[model samples]
Target: MVNNTDLTICLFPKALSIPSGFVTLGICIGNVFVIVSVYSIRSLRKPCYIILASMALVDVLTGIFGFVAGLLFALHGRFFYFGDTVGWLLHKVMVSTIALSLLHHLLLAGDRYFAIMYPYMYIIKVHNRSVMLTLIATWTIVILGLIVILSPYYSKDVQNVLEYTFMILVSTQMYAFHLRIYCKAKKTAGQVSSSTCQAVQNNRSDFKAARITSIILGAFSICILPSLIHSIVIETQGECGRCRLPFYVCSMLAYANSMLNPIVYGISNKTFSDSYKKIFQKIFQKIIRLC
Candidate 1:
């Protein structure tokens, strides 16, 4: 329902166009590597990695859509060409992708939580099939939720309330799950001395995975909180002329999360780091042969 005139009135500075383009490109390329690594590396085909790959896939879409939207914004200072409906849908899809990315973080945290807190059951239940089913369900729910929110039945206020509620619930659950995981890992470490060597090794592996996931979760929280707060303020107070710039900055920060995630995974997981190296080596060799 946003018109071009209103959009142009609050257009982001043209100087931001290049930097935003680069960031969006990085987001797409980085997440593509994540998805490829997860699929190609047999070792990374576990539940946690599957969820991570799914998240990366969503991020790729976000970056692509965001690039188009940003390009339009920067070029014309508004989505003048797309008309209201298409432009509105593009923005909504981008928002939905971000929501999907956050849900995947929760899914990743849950995977780690169960792996650490209930290893036996986790081994039995959290396989490829179950993970796939869970992802399908998540996609369906989010898509349906987006449809309901976008329907004319709900006012803008209602949509904002629903979004705010969803964000809080997901953030709370993810934090709670990680907190329980940390407590469980600490307690198990104290008891490790009496355990068998194999058990200890397994415990260490689980703890390591949990730690890496925690880092990703922390990064997501930091990146998203600014945008979430800015959004709430804008919704409640109505738009301020000065607030527009800050909102754009906050949105860019949120977009930065997609770029940061792949780096975190590579740095935190030796397996992913090695896979990246191997992929680069292959590409290098191919270029050399071509030359």
Candidate 2:
């Protein structure tokens, strides 16, 4: 007779295990490069960069948490390993960091919208004192949300409510940011240079901002849906459906959101792409010279 744990372990190895393992491991590795790229470059230090840095920090933690637990599950088959009180605390920080990243990225969309469309107004409004105040308020709001999400009895049922609410609000907010940008483009007499005109007329700059914001928003919802459903069902005595397919798909998509930041910058920002390439070449050449 097969034991429950042994049976659980056996089930995954027989199924679509290869792809599941690949995305998890690859994302974890890629996020390290993304983290290094953001912090090493000085020009990336705009306030929106504050949001990006936060995203990178959180994603790195998420990758760590996910891979550690995920790889263990893959190898052991059916084991769900979490430590005691200490593990619990670490988990909270990890969850908070991830949640905070999501919230801050939403703020980043708003930040970029203001910076791009109303550059002068933004500087005046967010001058030294105001910038600090806004950041402080944002920090407080995110911390409070994280606390509520990760507090006691973290079974999947509570997770569903949280996920649903988070998604609905995020989706709504993205549209709001989208609407705001469209309104600005209509109202303003933007620059007419070949480059800056391309940026403003085609709305390239704002669109680039929106691209990151939209992807972060859209991918987050798409990636986490299965996890949300899985958590709730598994926790509450709901459908114990063996839909490894959905979980695996969702997990991979979620992992991509972490590394996708760098890929977006590479495509959208010429300066960032050039700067990063130069920095990496320098580092590589120095290593070769040393050798």
- Give the per-residue lDDT of model 2 (tens digit) for 57-104: 667676676666555556555323332333344445655655666566
> TM-score winner among the candidates?
1
Which one wins on lDDT?
1
Overall lDDT per candidate, in order of appearance: 0.82, 0.58
Residues forming the 10-long window of minimal summed lDDT in candidate 1 = 1-10
lDDT of 1 by residue, 1-291 (tens): 444333223556666678788888999988998999999989999888899999988989888887888866756676323445667667667768878987998898899988888889998888999999999999998898778756766566676677789899999999999999988877877666577789677878888888989999889888899999888887677767333678768877898888999999999999989988888899899999999
The TM-score between candidate 1 and the true structure equals: 0.91
| Native-to-model Cα distance after best TM-score fit, residue 113 in candidate 1, in Å | 1.1
